[model samples]
Target: MIETVIVVLHLLVAIGLVGLVLMQQGKGAETGASFGSGASGTVFGSQGSGTFLSRVTAILATTFFLTSLGLAYYASHKASAVQEAGLPDPALQVEQVAPAPVLSEDVPVIEEDVTPVPAGEDVPPAAE
Candidate 1:
């Protein structure tokens, strides 16, 4: 559930980053133009969109990068909801097992001996 939320946030951040990047002015637009032409001194405007937009873009980029790392961490650590789960590994898996007893073809094992009693007499306990 947390992973899903992070994925959604990551996608939103990526889209925001792309939009911000596209909206910003590219190289050789306004800053260098005012330097080459002395008609105007346009280092920064009253609204200062260049600095503000760039700062926002940088923030979005960082967020996107962090979300990407989070997704990678989740993908590497979490297991799938299937029988044969995410990557074949030992900590997540062991062997398939069943409760089976081993049998051998050699002579059968006996724990105690059995002896026949005398025909019809009550036998007294033998002195040990």
Candidate 2:
């Protein structure tokens, strides 16, 4: 249950991070405003949006990292629990089947006698 919650939270944080990153304007956008493009009007003022968006992005990134680590930990812990319950580890389990006998070159192979017909010959019907 806890792992499920963490996974959901992790996915949400990842999506949010993507959205937040896409919503932020590129560094080149500032250059346009300086050339009198009248791009100075911003919702979070001149410099405030940068700080706020950066801080939010940082927080989301941290959350994403934490959730990633948490999910990894839980997965490993569950695997170990299964191992502790006397189930063999798949990596260590080896079936002791008998190896196949290697064929030697000394073995004789029988070949069938096949005859080829000429290309322009009138073909005869196959015998029953």
The per-residue C-alpha lDDT of model 1 at residue 65 equals 90
Q: Could you give candidate 2's per-residue lDDT for residues 78-105 as a string of tens digits?
A: 8899889989787788989998998889
Error (Å) of candidate 2 at residue 7 is: 0.5
lDDT of the candidates, in the order given: 0.76, 0.86
Candidate 2 displacement at residue 55 in angstroms: 1.1
Candidate 2 residue runs with Cα over 4 Å from true position: 34-41, 90-128
lDDT of 1 by residue, 64-125 (tens): 89999999888775544332564465566777999797777786987765576898988768
Clash-forming residue pairs, model 2: none
Error of 2 at 65 (Å): 0.3
Span of 10 residues, lowest total lDDT, candidate 1:
39-48
| TM-score, model 2 to reference | 0.63
